[model samples]
Target: MKDGRHLVWILDDEWNSHELEKSMYNQHGFEVKVTRSDKLEDDMPLYAPCADGVVAQVGFQCRADVIDKLQSCKVISVSGAGYNHVDIEAATQKGIMVSNVPDYCAEEVSNHTLALILTVTRRLASYNRKVREGKWDPLDTMPIHRLSENTVGLLGFGRIARMVAAKLKPFGVRILVHDDFVTEETFNVHGVEPVSLNDLLQQSNILSLHVPLTTETNNLINYERLKMMPRGAFVINTCRGGVINEADLETAIKEGHISGAGLDVLEIEPPSPDHPLLKMDEVFITPHSSYLSEESIDELRTRTTQAVIDGVHGKHLPYALNQVKTETKI
Candidate 1:
């Protein structure tokens, strides 16, 4: 280490580190380097060799090849919760700790999920558009069911999903949760009914995904599973875009099988302007911003940087996703 200062690299063009956060790192004797690169593979060879730690953002793939080339990197800290883009197995083999900031935006994401559910159930967007076009009619939003009579299903009962359940309780909706890892006590505590995956899909009037994107969860919601839901069922996703098969969802909406969808993410971010889902009146899309709030962003940045600092100092990371035997000395 030059002058006993650890070298940390920030690899994301889209997000700039807060000045205060940088200053804190500097105060801790860290030499922070910020690099903006659209292509991670092309840039890693040049920068990874010098970096003692790295804080990666979404859209930057940290695959096995990149992890293999990290010469001095003792830790890789992900800015957000999901770390599917990073090859944890390879990093573990190389004795590099991988950490993620998982709880920073739980409230923001849960709030966004509730917002999507309300928008779809109330048909607010469609009505607003029609009214602006001089076609206002109360009957335009017919078949609106009372929330109390409908069932809202959660695909994963993690922290965000629990928050969503708590918020939806006031709406008087029946909540059904499907998660393999959660126990019966968790369901009882939340006052949510636990069900199998297939049962949740078949029974929910609106299904919301809260699972991470992984090998098992990628495209977890495919055509067959989409068809399992009752006709006219609505779908909502605030989790990883790859969890659902976009092509199949489009087909279900087009064939009038599924009523609508409220998505905060897509299989591809900033999808082509002419994408089929963009043209559908029943579809509501956000720019993968379900986890965004001023407070949440600040928390995410602070926690991520702190994790990197902890790793460099040989302290155990609180949000470590994988255990690694690091060779870096304290």
Candidate 2:
């Protein structure tokens, strides 16, 4: 929309290279400029504000102050499913569309979710530690339950959660879900039982959180909620870390009420070395890698660029998260 070409600013630090984005934008007659700064407020130059579109990564927060500086920005394409990093309200008010690639890593994340479930349920990590410590006895970690006997509860029924349900079907485990937004027909189609939040907390033998982090969901699984689960219940979270109160989780685990947990994310990224959960043998942690895969990354980049392209051309944004009016068009 500027200088006879669409201008895109890549404000991201997660990826190693912007060659993919640059190539994609260049093919569409667009000029792409990248700022590999994780913190835009401290690092972005003032002249960088005149972008027609933006491609953002999780590490960069496009807050109200930052969004206000984008004088010509028509759209912002977040490179991943979660758009929590972007100030959606500010963008909408500024007539800038916000889009996210929600389905790009569905398979990868679902696979990681199932893997974490199995790792905790089967006591794989505990046994592995024992074996390494020269303890060679299966009874060292007994009471391993069959996956079919344990009820697996999914916190949300979005694309990733539904894919998880489909993957869990062949395992024959009873799946319970608690998402007020999801209809009963969705539960029936997936052969999952729809339950109230209280029931979900009380009945699930293994609970996996898949909800987004918002005001309502932040610290949703606090001390009281964790206590509601059956004693010795396992917890799995592939979603946002803020959804669970980390301090309360540690207390519940220390009290032996919650048996174990598989966490792909934490309230803090790269948690401190002395973090209580990190030292617990009952807890397993992955470095926020649930959504990683070569194919997934490729798809994410392609879709994210396409979103900006569509937005600058005044076409409907396929993965739009907010409504906005823009004057820029092809």
What lDDT does each candidate get? 0.87, 0.89
What TM-score, to 2 decimals, does candidate 1 have? 0.95
Quote the positional error of residue 120 for candidate 1 in Å. Answer: 0.9
lDDT string for model 2 (58-120, tens) is: 858778888888878888999888888899999998889999998989999999999999998
Error of 1 at 237 (Å): 0.1
- Ten residues in a row with the worst lDDT in model 1? 37-46
Off by over 4 Å in 1: 2-4, 39-46
The alpha-carbon deviation from the true structure for residue 203 of candidate 2, after best TM-score superposition, in angstroms, is: 0.2
Residue range 26-52, candidate 1, lDDT tens digits: 888888777676556566666777778
Give the per-residue Cα lDDT of candidate 1 at 61: 76
Instruction: Tell me the spans in candidate 2 whose CA falls farther than 4 Å from its real position.
Output: 1-4, 38-43, 326-330
> What C-alpha lDDT does candidate 2 achieve relative to the native structure?
0.89
- Leading candidate by lDDT: 2
